[model samples]
Target: MRIDKYLWCIRYYKTRSIATKACKEGKIRVNGDSVKPSRDVYPTDKITVRKNQVNYELIVLDTPKSRLGAKLVDIYRKDVTPQETLQKLDLLKYSKEYYRKRGMGRPTKKDRRDIDDWFDTPESPENKDDSEE
Candidate 1:
């Protein structure tokens, strides 16, 4: 099976096109070397997919004729991703959740209007003196 097709079959990517795109971008590696989307994938081939800031290591166990069910996915490939990498992914998720305060993200519509009103209004007494010079 083609590398892209294999990835899609295993549900690694939502679509074959996405897998193909990833391969073209050099995000898919076979046996440690980046492979093209058309690269042939056979049993025992080692695959490394870089996605969502993680490097997923998989060993091909068999090539399925078609896409496999979520429960059956393990029959086709074996995931050997490191424990540390998965732990880091968990840490990354937690860090992102608290990266910003609840109300400190992008300004809301009303906040934007308030900012525009502030800037569009006449200069304040403190600002007026600086412009005169």
Candidate 2:
């Protein structure tokens, strides 16, 4: 199976287009070397993917023609290392931080005022009087 197809079938990506995009962007590698979307993949081949802020490493155990159920997904691929899982957790932490800092709803008039106030803070060195010392 092609690497992109295999990745799609295994549910590594939401769609084949996404898998292909990742491959084209060099986010997908085989055996430590970047591979094209058309690259053929076989059982036991190692694949690495970087999506968003997290990385994933998976070993192909079987090539399925279609997406499998959650229980059967394990039959196709295995998580070879903990790096990606750790990175994903870290990414989630960062995402939460971002949402907390930026707020989640559509920007209201008050929100815009707050944002402008933050940017206009006189504490910024560029706006400070250096000669005051």
Candidate 3:
């Protein structure tokens, strides 16, 4: 099976097109080497997918005739992704949750203040004295 089709079949990606695009972007690797969407996938091929700040590792078990059910997905591949890898995703999510959503326009006054506070530094003694003068 093609790499993209295999990924979709195993439910790694929602659509084959998305899998293909990810492959084209070099987000998918086979046996530690990057592969193209058209790359052939065979049993026991180790796949590494970089998605959402996580590196998901999978060992292909068999090829599927078509997209498998959620419950049947385990029969096609074995997930070997590290726990820390998944944990990082959680940390990243929670860290970004406090930020404003994209396309929401410019920051508000409070947001600006928060940003300023985050970047604000204390003035040196010389600079402080100069300002006082």
- Full-model lDDT for every candidate: 0.95, 0.86, 0.92
Comparing 2 with 3 on lDDT, the higher-scoring candidate is 3
Better of 1 and 3 by lDDT: 1
lDDT of 1 by residue, 51-132 (tens): 9899999999999999989999999999999999999899999888797655798987888998899889776898988989
State every prediction's TM-score relative to the real structure.
Answer: 0.78, 0.68, 0.73
Clashing pairs in 1: none
Roughly what TM-score does model 3 have, to 2 decimal places? 0.73
TM-score, ranked from best to worst: 1, 3, 2
Candidate 2 per-residue lDDT, tens place, 14-123, comes to 89999999999999999999999999998889999887666788998989978777788998999876865886788798887786565677887889999899888557
Report each candidate's C-alpha RMSD, comma-separated, in the order given. Answer: 8.8, 12.2, 12.8
- Put down candidate 3 lDDT per residue, 1-133, tens digits, no spaces: 8999999988889999999999999999999998999999999999999998789999999999999899999988899999989999999988886676754779888888988999888878999889889
Better of 1 and 2 by TM-score: 1
Q: Rank the candidates by lDDT, best first.
A: 1, 3, 2
